[model samples]
Target: MLDAHLVKNLPDFKIDVNIKSAKGEVIVLFGSSGSGKTTCLDMIAGLVHPDSGHIRMGENTYFSSNQKPFPAEKRNVGYVMQDYALFPHMTADRNVQYGMKSVGKSEKSLALLDQFGIRHLRNAYPHEMSGGEKQRTAIARALAAEPNLLLLDEPLSALDDKARHDALTVITDIQRDLDIPIIMVTHNWTEAEKVATSIYKIEKGRLI
Candidate 1:
């Protein structure tokens, strides 16, 4: 299970939230802009620290008020940022291989691309790919690291109607295959309803 209770004082307001999700579950943090949804995901991903609280995945304690927080690199989290965050200069295959620790990185990257149905774009750079293609590559790269948790921030916001539909299907397949806790942030209720196994609505800085 993934469990977290986070408290952070922002310049304008305080963020306080408690969330939990079991394996194979997709939890949507549904909220509007500045509702602290991204902050929650950031804290969980170890990119931001909480004022006081705890974060845990199964038996591993990622953060606590008393103990030193675990380092972000060691957290083994796959984070897909709002922008997709793919390296502009790197090709699809290279981007996928960037975080992999396993041998035969090339082979594994290709396989992952194939799994996402983008093997043909292995040599294409981010600029050459469409929004949907870039999203798929970003996701495939995240999975390449074999993370224990997945964090997605406005993942489908960049895509058009058809692309969004295709991306949603990809996300569903990922959740089913990986069986890990996926915490996704989105302001769209319709998107949240389609992808979430459970949803937590946030308002201001708290769950509403």
Candidate 2:
């Protein structure tokens, strides 16, 4: 579960969000390019600190104004970014293994790769793989840690139409197989429909 009510004051604008997600639920967040959807997810991932309010994952209180802030590394959150941030120099398998809290290339990690249909591409570098393949590798990397919450921020936006559709399939499988709460941020309603169980639309820094 995720419960967050955060407020961040910006020079040009402000962001305020109060949202919750239950276990096994995929909540997709849609908004314009400058909307705070990605910032909200960043707060949940502990990458961005809220000036006030609280954040909780399951029974754990990760962030609260009254308590100590949890370090980003200790938050145990899986994050897939918009650029699909794979290392250009590393092979897909190695890229997936890098910086994961969960050690070893266990059966579980391999199983996730297999489910994403990227098992064969493991030996290939990010430069050698197609757009869809690199995106899947990034997903595998995020899931490898068995995070408490998975945050995907417009991960398929760079892909073409066909690749975007294909990424949706992998996203769906990950949500079902992991049974963890997923908060996905996107501007594309079509992709959101394909990947999300419930929808949340953001406008002017508020859920609309």
Candidate 2 residue pairs in backbone clash? none
Q: Model 2 over residues 1-208: C-alpha lDDT tens digits?
A: 7898988876667888898898888999999988888888888888889999999887788899999889999888999988888888888777877756555665666776787888888789888888888788998898887788889989888898899878887778777777789999999888888878889899867788
Tens digit per residue, CA lDDT, model 1, 66-161: 999999999999999998999999999999999999799999999999999999999999999999999999999999999999999999999999
By summed lDDT, the worst window of 10 consecutive residues in model 2 runs over: 99-108
| Residue 187 displacement in candidate 1 (angstroms) | 0.7
Predicted model with the maximum lDDT: 1
Best-fitting candidate, scored by TM-score = 1
Give the runs in model 1 whose Cα sits over 4 Å from its true position: none
Q: Count clashes in each candidate, considering only residues at least 3 apart in sequence or on different chains.
A: 0, 0
